[model samples]
Target: MADSLATWMPPLASLDDALLRYLDQTGVAVLVKDLTSGRFTAASPCAPRVLVASQDIVGQTDAELFDAVQAVALRAADQQAVALGTAYAGEHRIERHGERREYVVWRHPVPASGEQGPRILSCWQDVTEQRKRDVLVQATLAQLEEQQKANAELRREMQDNQVRDSVSGLYHRAHFEEQLRREADLSSREQREFAIVSVSIDGMDQIRETYGADSCERVVEALGRLLKANTRAMDSPCRLGGDRFTVLLSGVGLATAHSRMEHLRKACSQHIVAFNGQQIPFTVSMGVASFPHTAGSVEELMRSADRAMAASRAKGGNHLTLASIQFVPAT
Candidate 1:
């Protein structure tokens, strides 16, 4: 009769038992717990090596092994899964053998028969290395962003220093020269028109003699501020030297340059420097020159403009002169 009963048993049940044994021998841990009682009902032999205190937790709740907060959180998660009739999978950290370890956990509800109540099956795998890798990746990304921001700030500072005048905080002569060369090259290559205007302040030596060097510096700084306020973005205004300024205007002809110079002259006439409660009025003489119409090369163009400026000063200061009228073409 016993043999007959054994023969009647299905092969699937035997296969399941064999599979469970195989998992245990292969070091794969398995655990089953009563949902209502919160006690472990089944624990494979391999569970002890993989999970801390696996043998002691067979008939105990999480409160017996973990802190009250962790136990409460675990119970809440299990209750939620049982209520929803679904599986819950997530990562968690646990203190085991005086060290904190990370684990990947999966929780599933198992339906029971009439004699048995519902239970939960909980499975876990160590993921400490993976967690560490994720932390490292985040740290690396933050570091890269910081480095990029620093590099951008440095580039902006360098550009600002390159364009700023050392003495007056205005555009310097080097910047203006570079702009003139660039514009001249563009004009010659693209057949476009551009203009250069040069201005020389009158009576600078008289001002220096009357006031100290510091006062002279103050006047120059004030003039620089005025030029910056008056010039457009397309116009490069620069302090060429003591009492000398230059402007490179893109896409402008000689006539337009002359008109712009007149406007600058009017603005300068209206400007007054206040020192020690005294107002000092100043005058400027300017000269205008256009590319291809005056002369070739930046140096030659500047020379022609200088000659016109000399002519304007010879005619008694505070005037705008066109270099084209006196421009001599190079042979």
Candidate 2:
């Protein structure tokens, strides 16, 4: 009975017609190949546009119609699907009619007929436009990323300029004060030690009278460079006013702070300002005050350092004085 039914079974004319209609409406290309012979069995009308011509492709192996590279890829995909008994899908680039085109190809196992051996059904759709769009989008995203990076760098430079001293390129007095306040708050909360060193240039009036404001400015600039060179990376130096500067030393004890101030003093004493072919010498007097040792707040620390600086100027003009450390007893 099984043999009789197989012999009298009608051909799948309706199913074939339906499949052809579906392919035409969807613009999909279909092809079937004999797995044993590696020859094309059927090609849909849309197959020619995707590089599979019905008249020339029938009964032709991929090795015959494609170049070595294309043949290798097609055969590999075909073998993969056959061995796994599963569908394989991939994007491939094929050259047809002197133009390169991209297609999304799929290979699936097909049941064999009585006369035909094992077979595989293959289908593909043109994806050239979609691939081009994807490439364009990726390039556009890369360009946007580069532009964003450049913009961020420019903004950082602008912000740095805004907070920096124009003449010395160090933090301006305003920015330095803000930073001192922040550090003071942190030190108070964390119970850490920090110091503020105030420096005053002695006899600036005489220098201005003898040389001029420009000469005085040059001297201040020289002193600023000397201070920066002598200071540590964590220290911040700023010009507080005419002939007055300040430094905030974080995590420094009185001994270390005094040493730092002494270094600055030596550097300032050595710095000579040249104006009108004349070498003019200057000196700086600094005062150091630490957090919780001298004062608990930013304003008090600055005041104590300022008073010590004035005392240093009275004593000589180029000496450093450590402010009296007043520590509050722990509760």
RMSD of 1: 7.7
Instruction: Identify the candidate with maximal TM-score.
Output: 2
What lDDT is obtained when candidate 1 is compared to the true structure?
0.76
Per-residue CA lDDT of candidate 1, range 200-279, in tens? 88778887778656667777777777777767788898888888888888888899888878887887778788887767
Question: Which lDDT values do the candidates have, in the order given?
Answer: 0.76, 0.81
Cα lDDT for residue 314, candidate 1: 84
Q: Tell me the TM-score of each prediction against the true structure.
A: 0.59, 0.73
lDDT of 2 by residue, 91-167 (tens): 78987657788889888876676776788778888888888999999999999999999999999989988987767
TM-score of model number 2: 0.73
Off by over 4 Å in 2: 1-22, 52-55, 97-99, 200-236, 241-243, 259-285, 309-320, 326-331
